[model samples]
Target: MVTGKMFDMTTPAALLADDTAYAEAVETAVKAAAAYYATGESALDDEAYDRLARAITAYEAEHPERVLPGSPSGKVAGGAAQGDVPHTVAMLSLDNVFSPEEFTTWAASVERRIGRPVAGWSVEPKLDGLAVAARYVDGRLARLITRGDGRAGEDVSHAIGTIVGLPEKLGEPATLEVRGEVLMTTDQFERANTVRTAHGGAPFVNPRNGAAGSLRAKDRPYTVEMTFFCYGALPLPDTAAELADALGESTHSEVLDRVAGLGVHTAADTAVPPRTASGAAEVLERVAEIAGLRAELPFGIDGVVIKADSAADQRDAGSGTRAPRWAIAFKLPAVEKVTTLVSVEWNVGRTGIIAPRAVLEPVRIDGSTVTYATLHNPADITGRDLRIGDHVMVYKAGDVIPRVEAPVAHLRTGAEQPIVFPEVCPQCGSEIDTSEQRWRCVRGRDCRVVASISYAVGRDQLDIEGLGTTRVVQLVDAGLAGDVADLFTLTREQLLSLDRMGETSTDNLLAAIDAAKRQPLARVLAALGVRGTGRSMSRRIARHFATMDRLRAADAAAIEQVEGIGTGKAPVIVEELAELAPLIDKLTVAGVNMTEPGATPPPAEGEEPAPSDAGGPLAGQTVVVTGAMTGSLEKLSRNQVNELVERAGGKSSSSVSKRTALVVAGEKAGSKRAKAEELGIPLMTPAEFAALVADFLDEE
Candidate 1:
């Protein structure tokens, strides 16, 4: 229902008279985006280019005959997610402009065609955040994908359910992927650093990086401090304002006002009049002014986004290699300065991959001091031809870890030499190995590190109150304890004999060790010197067997049979479990609690069991766990039941299914329970359905 005076692109036939020509235009746009991304120069700013891309897609959607080869509309990039979700589109990146001068040139070009200067413009601050595609189905969020390598990104829909600022369902029933940026709140970024400081881990460098990295960690736990907003909708919305109105869930800047109503954030600053008006110069002026004020914004801003407010004009402008002619992002200049590369050092990771690091003359950048930065790997040294004494340029990607962006090679003298990776592990003196992706230490199995007592005392584990990494290392080197088990063997006399262990501290340390003995098998599994088996996976492995004895006895096939375990991992798991059997038995005799009891079975059938204060809610409710239960991922069956009880307000019964309240949970689910849970709720346990139920129940 939207149109413009000068351009007519409402219908597919109107946009391109020839079907072949339309297909070529689509191909041209996809290729242009790929080529521009390949080169340093971008074809269009992200928003503009995306609009054009959407228009091309709209054309194709209207006329199947216009569908072309390599049409972005035909194929969607698959998102790689640890959970069950999949992405319908591969979100692509926009070529960015870095200065106000670039913005002026772009606006002028538009004006030359429009035959008039732009009218009054509106301006909004540019926000620095992660680019993503959030897909919705039936008005509910379906999937979220990152812009990976331009083809496919890792799927992160599960994280979406937990991400606080996004809505699980929109105002209307619509199936589309709303693309935008996800960001860390200002307060979160500041508080994150404080917590990071409390631990030995370095604080997150910036909000954007924190948001991006959190979505991809796949294993590390993340928080709900992230937020998202949509500026544009795709496949093209029924109308632009309608979509913008959906974004109005957040704000009311005319353009953003509509977008906010659509439940998206509007970063529209200075909405200049149509591309045909005289206000064009004003648009350029305001964008330039923002370049100066951007750094002062409460959150992060990478660039200003300028887009055509009219949906029809956007279709007319269409798309080129990587962007649309209707919109452009003017990026702020890089915060670059000179600093000395004090020294080069090589560090070995747990994997035994040796990489070079640059120690620098401490300098501040974007607000923080720059003392050191990662060089990525030794190949970077030889490729960049870096020298230790030469000055280097360091860059932080949206405030994340600062990396040696590139060397100021011109400052280097003839003294530069190629850096080398260490041939062996420094700690264990084992040979090094290499992968297609990374260099690895060939020390213990999976290059396993001897569990540093530091981990043993971590909050989730032993939690020895006062012990820290520095002290743990000291204790280990002094031979006070050899492994997690040896901690208990220490007495007051033994501890006081060490560097700083006082009489009172010794008692506390002993208490912690005693407490760790009672930790469950899953924690012990995580604590043991195993490769790739973290706490989450450990719980998963524990659920496969009734007791530590059973697990230690399991073969790879038995282990792999457990959901989530794949063939590639079978051997590694089998070998480790067998190797650790002796140690597990020793600890068992040492009075360590191994496996925790499985979920209390649902109350027996027809038995008048006492009404306990805290009986299992899901008890006696027949349930089936399926693809990616957000809860209890490790305990496949118990997890499914947990979902039924905790998420769906249903229960679990061991023997009854047809009579059960719900048999909910996803793929790989047997037909027996599906038929039962399917009765009224038809409880299909797909991770998605469970999530949908969860969203609804949460409202109560």
Candidate 2:
């Protein structure tokens, strides 16, 4: 359903010409739909399933005679499921549009069909859950039914007490049918898995699947609660004919309001609520707003549902077999997908930490093709029972790296192979240090000389202008440099002898290396690639200790005195610093600055240091910078902004939390910005952030 073009895709037309390929695609789609609708478990993820369905539809349009009877198009639950219980009215799925252009075209068609422009539009999230109808008799809940095959549904009245937000008895005694979605909240999903596993049940694959299983499940040892969000309501039975007629005539938003009054929870209860928009542009704006909030929502929403608010207009537009002409779902990108774990590659980092990365069969997720996902470590793979050829659920949120959530154990075909842990260092073929969960090369940084040296000269570290990975590799291979310290000792003639090294280039490289020697202790420390220290942590340490001599002299307890360094991490930092003592001595001899500028040392010995100034603008505050810097802050990287935040007397955090004082949101800010807005955290633009830290910027 994603509007963005998928990667590694075979043309739909190409597949249509081959009967074997067409049948295979159809069979795959049909099976996936059957499993998805019946048990809420499917081998194919939403994205893959939707792609197949779309292709089948396109093929059917071109070659009607070749259309298969089991095709998933224009059918509720892909016609894979059915129930005998008849519905008072059909429970239908909405048609989808992937972009504003498609949505505008759909709106135009609807207006043209109705012989007038729509009065208004109501927009709300299209909850990614199973649709169901709850019928209440005299305001007392009587039956719960799944939207099986649209015309009829299965009786799931047994799940009556397990659903939240759907009152057993209405505020007023009135017979009505509330149409809505049944889904588990994010917290509920996690708790459900914990409880299920505790009771010897296999954990549910995802929130949507868990909700579906929970809804129809009977005779289980434990109950996992699901929430019901009312999307529509209609009158049912003979006792509420008048109310039914009124509901039939009422606008969609008005219907939601009426249902809320009857003790049914609706989107109106949350930060993101349904709203009425006057035109297509407003509707699109609301759609974008909902999409922006998707990552922060407590539950999943695959798209935004936009419908004509006028009941009269709805009647004029009429309906199709699958969806109403008056409504359309604006689909967003798929955040999760099921893919095969083809292999696992262990790569050595600059610190010699060997990390396992899962090589997956290319799958499109969140508008990008992902073939590799972070695997944490061999222990994580073993703990999750991940195996080669396993069907793994891949999760990607915003710009965060894709990661394997877990393997879909139930979908395995027994061709899976156990993921073997490396016995030796994969990169340098040396003995591996397996004492820690993350295996490392016994040779440490020496095993990755080029990477270590490249990181040292990076822009956020020593900031040597002419040095890059290619140049670092060249120097390492040519025997001119073996480590970061060697960069400062390089002769001008040696640099000039390298390929493409002109006289101007050689001088620029030399000058850059010379300039790098004067960088503050914080930058120098960051360049050293300490196991637990990045730019921010290095800055904090330098600011706390003021000089390398003081930092090297501090023990774990003394290091813990600095903010954000925990007791457990303090000892690791101490050990890493001890190991790097030789390298530190080498850099010191090379004349790199040994103290951070503008920093005052801690009070001598055991005396308590003077308290920080409470009047400083960002004092005692935690700030997070996200997206891209702009205006005067454009030239600064995220690390530089963090440095500026610290210099301005604030603690910089990468994650947004309840304790976060503010968020500096910039261009294209995604989840963090949404989270800040959701949590009511104050937000400052890059310009505002620049203004707030003007003094620190001037110092830089």
Candidate 3:
């Protein structure tokens, strides 16, 4: 930990920057943080972090290129990370409140300012993601900006190019401004975790971290590389219900709808401020009740924000020079528990990676049990220096994955044993390679575990139906099958013998497995669990070599020749094929259809289709036009292009997907157009896409 001498509140300390001023700075920061998190405020989110962060920044600015070792600015909000944006709106953090007394005190503070109990306010969920702004002019999206330092930010304007849901334009008329949060979906986070593990990057603590990291990643090519969502808008409408009612059911929803619409994501139910803090507290309780549901929501939120509804009253109320006076946020406490790490267990994965999981004495957190949090892999144990019998502090970090925050080394017994990792694959007995994040068994195709089984039964693999997770677990637990070869060898009678296995279900499963045998060699290769090969990669290999034996006969040189299969991946391919070859021959001899039928098919006789299966100007084109798009020429208006193209049987692509055709250039198209060019995709002026979609443009 970076530590510095405690600053003296008033005078000089040679060891410190300025002892007296530094102490005052520290006090101010702590006070600001205390104000932020104690209650979740609709006024501003992440208040505690914001308050201290601002204090640190002020001191840093005074002494350029200098930061206090222990200053809050040096760390992320939760004291977990240390990466900073160059100079976004100094991201002033919010203060929090937990108890009704604290909430009441904050409310009284607001009341004191307003000189009366303020009436009519809006309370919104404090979505735990990067906050951004959408500026629309003449009913069209002009620019999408991030809340960098609350004032200035890097022109991530390119996000408009790829982030879904945020439209290139607004749904209503006249210039409109909207502010919302960008968040990640659970599926996306899980996928990122898998990828990050593979990439040797730090695991993102939560969706908020995921969003913040991705959005600020200068190297990231697209915003969707981190999923984004827009919730809550400014420019309050006449009535609370009217504005809330219009969000989903109006043109405004449509204009900014592309971000969420493309993904089919839903927003949290918004509500106006309850008549009283008790009522507001009750709504917050519901938010807390589903805290475990952080995984289910398409977006992430930390707590509920309650705001006074009356815009006029809100103006009359004013703010604290730091946060809005009309709003207070009620946040659920972080799910932290003091649990004994009774023991540690090492489990091997499909690839023979040994992952250590902690077996904790049971406790409740976020409404779930307190046992068995993943240690990630053998390496994590050493990095964290965790051992069995440590009285550890475990918290459901970010309300998703449970992790050991820290160990109470003070409680460690002198007799604790250091954890050890296995040197061989438990399933196949292959030698393991101890690495930083994983213990890999180099046996390649031979090891049998979760990743392998999932790959084998994947949609592009054996295509087995009725052989879902339950059946797989049953088969594995029964000890009758140790490998994929055993799966094809199972008889209906053997399957029927398992508990809960009905005759009809057994018959259907057998049929499904039988049907899967006829699938092509690419799928066979995919099912064999090649480390770096996926369905898409497998397809590239198949396109290069049709039959399994044919591909197997080829060496590493030939495998590397495939479009997607790089030389680095070739050895894994060859190793996998070598291990699975005998099994394939056995299955083939077992009457499984191992190859595609018939003689080599004739080549296509016509010109190849456009890169996109459908070819029109817009077919292989992407356009993001901001500002007023005037006149018809197959030209999509900023207001209507999103729906028009999609409705016209064309898909509007996000900033980063392979499906993006061309990003249409427009005035201040922001980050989307630049990102399109960076991605090496074509860029087109409105006229270019216009001439293509003549039918729609000619309507006028």
Candidate 4:
């Protein structure tokens, strides 16, 4: 077990004075580093480890004559890892600065050491993964070596064929060593875990751990893919003298470009590529820019690296025993934290999917106190080897929900208990369907009547003002309602008999329920909570068929003609609507509206077809709206804008794809807007979209 007492004892004099405490602190740090470097699993998170190491460094600086041999100060991998294979050039670590003030101080020091202003700065994301040296001989990938220590590394050539971006052959015939990081992208990590578990292996806790373990493994039944991104390149001792001279003379930016040209991946291939910053200010700006885009990046980054771009400047600044004097890492806040798994909760969703949720020990991560995280499914819990009372890594990025990455098995004390999954539905005590990865109640939405009914009364659905989840549960428990259709049959006397139901509240609720009968067929379909349809999809379906009777008559083939409804989903929708026939009949008898306004119904058999509105600007177009609207659209909600699109004879979509006809990009448009541009889809500003849809705006 690793102790974090040193994190609290930050004072150098206080730690140096206590001999026993100081020694314990050193031992704790050494063990943490060893675990982190060897398997990418540590008892402490990155921020905690950094703080403890900084304290040790401060104490050592004051008592240089009494420094311990196991001290982590001025050491690569904290002097905990070593190997026999010597690196062509020392794979030195970068000294870190946590803030802009510290970065500015480091930059000033580098300028003073060089005796002149630096030529330029190269700023790039500091990838969070295992550092390695990839050697090439005669343009062929020859070996892969991990950065065991600064001077030497362990050979991991077994991973050569499995790594993407690091090609088997270079674009040109050359003998050199390229230094880069080997990591699993977000998508790769999930796939690796799935493949690993299928092969009867324990799932890796995180991407970094997966990469480290996969890189060194041999003779495994499964191969997990990883990605490589070169940050620097150097000439080997056997390299041509002319090439060595050119490599030594080239600037960092130029060398990276050449690396990318040689079929080796670099930061140049990413969205936030290395930029040449004129000074410290620009470098800091680049750092912030990269940090802002961290959540959106495919791979993980712990910090941003800033280095002197000019080779001459790097030579003048010189190197330290563990790091370079000319480069510094601007560290970002840690997005992952190690916390205890207190317990697991099984929740029945509206559709009866029994999801497992991890209850954590309230650890602070990425500026929030995360007490709960998503566990995905029961299979995930088993594959990850997670247990109650075990230490687990909790990861949160930007607006995404927190998730339990994996259990830190090394930190288990044997007291941890296995997480038990339910054989029956947790909410209704019914048999669960476990054929799929996600367990579900055999009764589907009926198993959770309260939640399903509450959704039906939501603002965008039936618009019943007084009915919420609590009221729905009360009504269900009192036997006054069993489903959305039963809600319309609730009588005044039955509602008045409830404990909290006053005369005023009951009358208001009754009026709301009566008003709901006139809602459009689209809203009524949305209230049904079909498995494969949502609000927008319901609008598309209702508009296509025009009436409930026609919609009930549609087969999978007819449903497939609706916008965004594919072959697979069309069948599912048709099946669900068929099962909901009894509920639809009840609602129809209760006088709920079954027709959509402004929708053109399909022609009857042997009937003449209506003329097409070919002159309409968006007659055959599929349009998507993204980001915050402005101008005339400022007062309109997203659903209202979608309504306007349909009124103008366009099919509105929530995602951008190759089939997308146009995109209305508003202010602060993010990935969807970017995807539209990438696909070469037509784009319009919000003002331009507003002008085009002016004739249909009032139709809402």
Best model per TM-score: 4
lDDT of 4 by residue, 408-495 (tens): 8878899999999898899999999999788989998888888899999998889899998889889999988889999889999999
TM-score of each: 0.42, 0.77, 0.43, 0.84
**Displacement of the residue 448 alpha carbon in candidate 3, Å:** 4.5
Error of 4 at 28 (Å): 1.4
* RMSD in Å for model 1: 19.8
| Cα lDDT of model 3 by residue, 1-700, tens digit | 1011111111121232475666666655554433222211112223333443455565677776555455555332323222223322233335555444455577667767878766533444566666666655555666666654443444556556455556665444444445666666656766664565456554544445455556556564233345444543444232245444444344323423433432322252222112222344443443333332333335555565666655555667765434566666665544555567888776666656566778899876555677878677765565456667766656574336787744545456787677766657665677776643567667644455445666587665777877777777788889756666678889878998999899998888888888877776656766776667765565446545656666778889777877667787788778767767777777677666555332132123375533322343454344444433554533433324653453234545433334576666656454444345435667666666667676654432
Candidate numbers sorted by TM-score from highest down: 4, 2, 3, 1
Number of clashes in model 1? 63
lDDT of 2 by residue, 1-700 (tens): 2232421132232345666677788898889999999877899887667777877777788778887787888987888878889999898888877767778889999999999999999999899889999999988999999999999999999999889998888999988899999999989987897787778676677788899888888999889999999999887766566788879999999999989998999998675688899988888766766776676678988888999998999999999898899999877778889989999999999999999999999998876799999999876676567889988888775567988877888888898999888888989899999888888999999999998998889999999998888888899999999889999999989998899999999999999999999999999889998887778888889988989999999999999988888988899889999999999998999988899876778898688977654245798899999989999999988888888888788889998878899999999887678768767899999999889888889876
Q: Tell me which of candidates 3 and 4 scores higher on TM-score.
A: 4
Q: Write the per-residue lDDT of candidate 1 for residues 1-700, one digit (tens) a residue.
A: 1112111112122355566666666665665555332221123333334445666766777877746656755332211112233334334444444444455677677656555544333344456676677777767786787665445566776687656446888777755566777777667666654554455343443455456656655564434367675555564243245554554332223444443455655443212211212255555555544543433345666566776555544544555544556667654534433577778876665434566779888865554677988877765554455666766656543335777644554346777555545667655677766653356566533343334445655765545566677666666777775555666666778778878778888788778778777665666776673555665566556545636766666677777766567987777778766756665666777788876444222233486754433334343444544333444233334523343343233333332233556554444443333234324444644554435455433422
Q: Which residue pairs does candidate 4 place in steric collision?
A: none
Separate clash counts for every candidate: 63, 0, 62, 0
Which 10 consecutive residues of model 3 have the lowest summed lDDT? 1-10
Sorted on lDDT, highest at the top, how do the candidates line up?
A: 4, 2, 3, 1
Q: Quote the positional error of residue 376 for candidate 1 in Å.
A: 6.0
Superposition error at 121 for model 2 (Å):
2.0
Instruction: Output the worst ten-in-a-row residue range by lDDT, candidate 2.
Output: 2-11
What residue runs in model 1 are displaced by over 4 Å at the alpha carbon?
A: 1-38, 41-304, 311-344, 349-416, 428-451, 470-474, 499-502, 544-546, 555-585, 599-700
Note the Cα lDDT for every prediction shown. 0.54, 0.86, 0.55, 0.87
